[model samples]
Target: MDRAALPGGVLTGLWQRARLVERRIETPTAVTLVLAPAEWPGHLAGQHADIRLTADDGYTAVRSYSMSAPVRDGLVEFTIQRVHDGEVSMYLCDDLPIGADVELRGPIGGWFVWRETETRPVLLVAGGSGIVPLQAMIRQRRAANSDVPFRVLYSVRTPEDVIYGDELADSADGVETTILYTRTAPAGSGRPPGRITQADLKTHGWTPGFDASCFICGPTGFVETAAKALVAMGHDSHRIKTERFG
Candidate 1:
């Protein structure tokens, strides 16, 4: 996944607006947008793009959003969470309409991507909307028919705030998943309702000798805490990769 070559001619065509081809409401707080570039350039899963828009007063705002669609998919999909007081998110969620056009540059970012050749077992940890990039990775792996073992530990404020809840649950039927709810109990199920901790990891059979490569993406503090916990459990730092969202 070469970041420099991504976006191709689209990078030079920033002044031109890319049309929104599709949109889906993922949850009360998030929406997924599918954009078709006037000219489509390939993008890798787990990579992100920069969307820029100019207001009537000539004020320009830009934001980076991770690609939600699998890399093999031709269109670009962005799963965006609405952020209160965020200039770009507010406009995208409240104002952007179907068939609207916006300036975008990328298929950028490399560090977050899992290249196709990677076959090691993967452990993904995400919080809230941070699951976007990891979703891409999971889809990529499934698309490739790769036999890699992968699992996800997704923490959210509550069941209501769990983005991609149904999809993730269905996907977990074939892959492992541990949902941690910080503000709500595990509804109906007898599973313990609490934040992730060392005991939770141990109970889930996550141990040092699993030969798994860990990828953690979430709010900065949660990611740091999870990483430290994994490290304390004797997982190699080199085997752990992380992306933090503020």
Candidate 2:
């Protein structure tokens, strides 16, 4: 069920004024917003926030977006991928002005989040903008100065579609990052463009025997395919967590 359709009392209590303090262009179609909320209860790495936009005509649209970075002071940040014909996303990525305010409620989703105290190895598989939350986990790991082993497998249509490309390149210090271009591989690339498969997971992902915690996020189809591949690679289903969006 859409949270917006629920009884107002259920969500109203969590909504607070969030002012857009900073904006960044992530890709041609994506934008990142840094907001300062009137109040915030710190959030876990993979959690998300719900933003509500109401027009003068009383029409309202609400959408959930994953946090892109760990909280710094009283600020929180999330990236918006402009969805064609998306009421909320289009406004957020193209029209929302700096210093403008929106009703924000979050620190949502506890099951898929990653905590700094976790010591086990982590396997992060992302498809397209699904990297948002996984990126948060990576940032949090660095912020906490954790040495936990992390391996990231990111699948995108092309190099141009990769989000946080520069930062991901710099994440090689302790994190092993691999980009698998599904449609257009860059020149001189060793692997041809293709969908993620069991071989890909076995070669790049943590071994099933390592007892790694796996987080997979993407569109429904992509998430399902990746999760299935992991299970086929002998990973315990219980150790896998997934968060998917359209």
Candidate 3:
């Protein structure tokens, strides 16, 4: 898309060279890469970048990854989860070295973003690495010192699968996170291991009458289930935004 058609009018379709400045391991299967694009006009919290990688034989692959944090000194961060047998993810998670250069085009997507001016209570639901963009939202909230209330329900297979574990635990005021273990519950856990049910939303999410703005991101099946549950509980479908990856 052209710049006029791009979200926020801050991105272009042309791919720019970006260099990896930092890398951090988020989980066994995920890694966070900080890249400094030659030029960046800034982006919304929930936007993403299309990363292009080329091989020695001239084969190229492109994939989209949500930003895990807000822009800092023109640097952008992406937390990528390695998909089994997936070339792009595997390379990004394991082989992409610091100081290497890659092609990036984005700050793409607009509908799923969160703005600081919003006053409605926010409900964020994420499954697995879907928490990346939502984490950017939380960081933006803190950075802007906006007191918008936020409630997060994060689903993972086990404790080790939770990304940004320490940061989520130490969230600022007006933010809260509830972790739901789908396959393994930790010791002394009161709840049994299970998928997120309507009951879970009712307990951890805003009341239907609160008119909260809901953002759900995850695998396709998980996102669908959560959206359906929220709708069944009377949340306006328009107020519930979703971003899914598989």
Candidate 4:
């Protein structure tokens, strides 16, 4: 039997150990880790994994982080932001050693995931670090070489806080990315800094008639407001999927 199989030969799919193979500092508060699990079954974009860590005294801590990019060669990527009061996140972003093993399980979460087979026009809205999962969907769309039109509306406090900003800016080939700076905009950008308003949605988003698949992720308030804006614009509620973070 293979290692993925249960010890009783039950073929049970369960949590397996994963080692952090690489880590990239995305920003002052955020970092992305590339991990290889011993029994990975592969994962869809936007799915998340729960990581488990144990202290020397047997105190275990677990936290879940969504996949930041499409699965590749069994390597799962998770982008984590450090919450000053969050123990797990603090460890992940500040002190976790490279090559250390952590217990991980998942590919969990079905509702928010984006499979490569989706062929319709794709719309993604992200606020703050919520871009992580949506970015995964974007990567999946590209990796599939599908001609599905992609659009992203990324809202950030300042130009410096945009996660994956360079890649988002370079999306001129087939994807369009719009930056909404709530606190400040880069010099030379004429648009005033503001929150995502109804007008902004109507201007940059798909109409209800287009039947585009929309994915919105952000803080609870941002997600709620964006989702409502889509609904008010006659978008079918069923076509919009939302994932909210703190």
Winner by lDDT? 3
Tens digits of per-residue lDDT for model 1, 147-226: 77778888888787877777778654356777888878665756666667877666653578876788888888888988
Candidate 3 residue-wise lDDT, 1-246, digit = tens: 001122343454679999999999988988999999999878898988788989999999888788888899999899988888888888888888899999999878878899999999999999888899999999999999999999999999999998999988976587999999999999987889999999999999998899999999888899999999999999999999988876
lDDT of 2: 0.87
RMSD, each candidate, Å?
4.2, 2.9, 3.5, 5.6
Ranking by lDDT: 3, 2, 4, 1
How much lDDT does each candidate structure score?
0.75, 0.87, 0.88, 0.82
**Poorest 10 consecutive residues by lDDT, candidate 4:** 1-10
Count clashing residue pairs per candidate.
Answer: 0, 0, 0, 0
Expressed as tens digits, the lDDT of each residue in 1-246 for candidate 4 is 001111221122577899999999888888989998997877778777678889999999877788888878888899888887888888888888999999888766777878877877888999888899899988888888878888899899998787887788877567889989999998987789999987888888788788999999888899999999999999999999988876
TM-score of model 1 relative to the true fold?
A: 0.88
lDDT of 3 at 110: 78
What is the TM-score of each predicted model, taking all chains together?
A: 0.88, 0.94, 0.94, 0.92
- Measured by TM-score, how close is model 2 to the native structure? 0.94
